[model samples]
Target: IARIAWLSMGLPLEVAATTVDSQCGSSQQATSLGAAMVASGMEDVVMCCGVEMMTRVPLGSNMKDGVPMGESYMQHYQPTSQFMGAAMIAEEYQITRADVDAFGLKSQQNAIRAWEENRFEREIVPIEAPVLDDKGQPTGETRVIARDEGLRATTLESLAKLEPVPGQSIHTAGTSSQVSDGASVVI
Candidate 1:
């Protein structure tokens, strides 16, 4: 992402580039690092950018080699979860399934309204997204996507009807974070 932005913006190659990963906090970490550089007088201006192509990379790719839950850690701790951990936390906090679903419904509705009102027009950069057909094969066509692909027309009733993973509570696809593909840049 940094390289593409550098070349596209006609920046010289001498400028240094660094990428940081803090899982869900990656973009925030990038921005914080950039700010630290500027604040410490090590740099005048720094560009921070983040990109996650979930369609290509998907989730849990980093866990292919297994999570680094060492023997001592595993002995004391339950197996770590990704999304399920959040669901567990919500349940522990006594947050009901209906509450989560209602929040999801409100979020989707707000996102839809934002797009309809053109609130994202200024910040969104159009991307040439792959055009996939029914079988998930590329159709040799590309579409300029300016809005989020994961926003769905949802309602409280619809969200309420979805089931959580078997034996789990308070979490379903409708109440969970949607899979998304997106990139953003800042200077």
Candidate 2:
């Protein structure tokens, strides 16, 4: 997918492209690799890019066999639990549910405000997306999509109403991050 995306961008075929999966840090890792390439004089300039189409492949899809625990790993560590890890961190840091909810509220508010102020216009690359009919054939119509589709108008009260993850603390769908689809590129 990364190679295909590079070609689709009209880059020269000789330019190397590869995907790096570091979970949520994929893009940051890609950018770091690009910077290293430039610093090492491997290339004049390099593009750092990453993307996740969460709509097609949801989060944790790659963890079907669990997080690849080995005997050596188990000897030194317990398998990481996403929820418990977050809960423990929150507890250790003395962050309360209200604090989390407040932060989530701020995020929601800021996103909406940014959209209204056209702050995202500076970075968003508009795409011409086909309008499809019910049967899935294109209707020959197209729309320009320039903004994220994940932002929602949320309140503290609304966030508080969400249920926590079954086994551990504080995080709810409202307070946690959203699953989204997007591609980003940096040169």
Candidate 3:
């Protein structure tokens, strides 16, 4: 997929194949590592890519036993800290439902506009999936998927109506980032 993506984007082969992982900052770390490699005379050029198919892979599946080990460690090491998404973000930034909803709305609007402008075409490779009928028989044609699946036509009214997810006091599907499948590359 990376190879195809790079080729489609007209990027050079020297700017390919490198990988990095830094939890949520994998792409940033990839850029830093690439820059360091070039500065240290390791390579002439490097391509850093980050692809998180969060929708396909359940959260915590990559971690050992799907456990919140980091939370446990923090609880054991620092009793005062509560390690969870909503609590952490809310405590850190005093984030409210309004703030989160506003951010989500902005994100959705930007994504929609980008899609409309065809700004993503240069990097997106339309993937074809077999078309199936109601009974699951292949219709002999393919359906192209070119857009990000995370986007939804949303409104503040709809957002305001959503209840927070279980165990989260300030987060809902409307106010939190969507589970998405996409890849990105930097040269």
Candidate 4:
């Protein structure tokens, strides 16, 4: 995928490209490796990149879906999802549901405000996306997508009305982090 994406970008074919995987910190790890390579005079520049199509693959399913995790990893560590980790942190810090809800409401409000003021207008790079039909085929038309799609308008009342996540009581869907389809690069 890395090589394919590199070629898709019209980069020089001579530039080396490879994918790095370090679990959740893959991008950050790539950045570190790139920096080390440059510092060691191995490369003049490096494009550190990472991507996750969470809408299609979801999170924490790679191991179950056949992305090898040897027996030792299975015996020693179990995946504690981000939501579960957040709950643990809240429990440790004594953060209440009310506090979490307030924070979530503030974040949503800020996102809404940013969009309203067009603060992200310059930061976002518009890309042409195909207009898909009911069957998901391209309809011979395209649209420019230039803004964040995950922002929501939520109030304190709405957030409070939501139910807690399955096992954790400290954080609900509104308060916890969400998975999204995205890619990122640091050059």
| Tens digits of lDDT, candidate 2, 6-52 | 79989789877888987667889999988998999988988787887
Which 10 consecutive residues of model 2 have the lowest summed lDDT?
55-64
The superposed Cα distance between candidate 1 and the true structure at residue 106, in angstroms, equals: 1.7
Residue 20 miss distance in model 4 (angstroms):
2.9
Which candidate number has the best TM-score?
1
TM-score of 3: 0.68
Angstrom error of the Cα, residue 29, model 1: value is 1.1
Off by over 4 Å in 3: 1-18, 60-83, 129-142
Compare candidates 1 and 2 on lDDT and give the better one. Answer: 2
The stretch of ten residues in a row with the least summed lDDT in candidate 4 is 58-67
The count of backbone overlaps in candidate 2 is: 0
Question: Which segments of candidate 1 are over 4 A away from where they belong?
Answer: 1-10, 58-79
Displacement of residue 69 (Cα, Å) in model 3 is 5.2
State the lDDT of candidate 1 residue by residue for 47-132, as single tens digits: 88887655554354423455576789998999756657877788788888888888888889998999999999999988787899
Q: 86-178 in candidate 4: lDDT tens per residue?
A: 888988999999999998888888989989999977656788888889865899999987777778788889888999988878778787666
RMSD in Å for model 4:
3.9
Task: Encode model 3's per-residue lDDT on 86-170: one tens digit a residue.
Answer: 5787879898878878888888999999999999889888888777797647999998888787788999888889987767766
lDDT of each: 0.79, 0.82, 0.72, 0.80
If scored against the real structure, what TM-score would every candidate get? Answer: 0.80, 0.76, 0.68, 0.73
Candidates, ranked, lDDT: 2, 4, 1, 3
